[model samples]
Target: MNTENARSQPPHEPSGCLTGVARGIALVVVLPVRLVWDALAFCLRQLWRWVLAPVGRALGWLIDVLLVTPLRWLWEWVLVPVGRALWWLVDTVLLTPLGWLWRWVLLPVAKGVWWVVDLLLVTPLTWLWRYVLAPVGRAVGAALAWAWHIAGVISRAVGRAVGWVLWNVIGRPLAWTYRVVLTPVGHWLRTWVWAPVAAAARAVRAAAREVRVALFGGSR
Candidate 1:
């Protein structure tokens, strides 16, 4: 009997309170986010349609029709013939003349001048050098060589005598004096002058260390 009563009851529907709460949450969280997204999309669509697309199409048409068409016609009609005419003019006027001058005038003249110089001046000068000046130069060079040898021998003997005198008179006496007298003076200077300076330097360093330790708060 209880089972039959339960089957006979109708299906339950949600309450108004829960449904109102769900609608409130949707308004707070989802509605504002969706509204903002729709506004941004509308703005972007309007920008592309009104501003960017028209400008892009105009620039593309200008580049293709106005600029590229005229350039192609100019290159074919004007530039090709002008370049060929300029090349022909340069070759006919400048290069041909220069080639003729080099082959006929400049080269022949240079060769003739070289031949004359060789025959007149160079051969005579070579003969003079080989026969006349060379023998005289050799004789003078032999005399100079003898004089240089004698001078070198005398110079070496004088240098030896000077060296001997310097060693005996100056160097030996100075060495002996340094060993006997100056050594004691140098030791006295170190013991008195240098030792006091060194001790002062060490004391200053120790004082600086103490000051640094005090400033930094470190153990001694």
Candidate 2:
């Protein structure tokens, strides 16, 4: 009976030790698994943050491209058509009559102004020149002619008086000098220079006659 009791006690003590070791192993495994799960959740959260950040940027870009671009394009389209319509209206309605008037009426009137200028201004100027300036020029010319004639008369009278005095006072002496001095000089020049020149001319004539005869074989 004592052996049976000791065996039972030993078995019970080993069972309790096994239970405690099982509980400790379960705690260790569960703690590591929870840590792994928490790390996985954190990684998933970071990945989702990275992906959503790019998606938000893409959405913002799409909004700007879709809304702002179309709005700007529509604005340009509306403004361009309005500007063209305004320009067309101005050209066709307003400027057309102005251009026509400038071409036909205003141009003709401007050209006719030259004719009016010729009639009103040029004709009067020509008449004034002929009527007023011609008489004045002729009167001035006649006065100048009269003045010249008076001066000529005075000059002629003075010249005649001077001539008479010079004739009386100096002409006799000059004539005596011409007779005394020039008569001998003229006779000497005629005797020396003219006689030599005449003899040389006769010699040249004789020489020319001999040369002609020699060249033409005595001419005969």
Candidate 3:
């Protein structure tokens, strides 16, 4: 009855010797794995706090001391002076002469030429067209209208001849060539050639912008 009662109740705990053997196995296997994990964690923490952090700070300080400060001084002192001198040389040599030519030479000559045209050519032509030519043309037209049927035919023929002359001299072919040839050619050049060149120019400008940012520390 007691055995049956024991079986019905529950299983008993392991003996002390078996428990001792199990603990020994755990010490051999799990103890070393835990020790290795703790050692790795400790090494990583020391490396980050002591070695890597200090090295990063030292590299930053070294870069500031060696490279950045000297470049700034060189840009401020040497490059700025050289640039200013070159600009001054160009202004003195190239621009001053052009300005003098405009102010003293070319300007007076152009003014004189324009005055001559206005006085001799334009004024005379304007007076002739308004007073002489326009009056003669109107008188001739009025006389022809009163003459006969033959005069009407002659006037029509004259009108057609004048129109022919004007069309041949200045109208359709020049307009056609501009529309067909020049416009399309200009469009093609703008699309294929100028577009690519403009894109490359923009890329170069962007690279220059990056250089400026680096040189000026990205502030101004």
- CA RMSD of all predictions: 21.9, 28.8, 41.8
Tell me which of candidates 1 and 2 scores higher on TM-score.
Answer: 1
lDDT of 3 by residue, 1-220 (tens): 9989878864776888998999999999999899999999999999999999999999988998899988999999999999999999999999999999999999999999999999999999999999999999999988877787777888999999999988888787888889999999999999999999999999999989889989886753
Ranking by TM-score: 1, 3, 2
Q: Which stretches of model 2 miss by more than 4 angstroms?
A: 1-71, 130-220
RMSD over all Cα atoms, model 2: 28.8
Question: Better model by lDDT, 1 or 2?
Answer: 1
Q: How many backbone clashes does candidate 2 have?
A: 0
Whole-model lDDT values for every prediction: 0.93, 0.90, 0.92
Which segments of model 3 are wrong by more than 4 Å? Answer: 1-45, 148-220
List model 1 lDDT by residue over 1-220, tens digit each: 9999878867684688997998899899998899999999999999999989998999999997998888988888889888889989998999999999999999999999999999999999999999999998998999999999999999999999999999999998999899988998999999999999999999999999899999997876
Model 2 agreement with the true structure over 1-220: per-residue lDDT tens digits: 9998887675545577898999899999899999999999999888778987788889989988999888888779987888899999999998998999999999999889988999999999999989999889999999999999999999999999999999878997788878998888898889999999999999999999888988886752
Worst 10 residues of 3 by lDDT: 5-14
Consecutive 10-residue window with the lowest summed lDDT within model 2 = 7-16
* Per-model TM-score on C-alpha atoms: 0.47, 0.34, 0.45
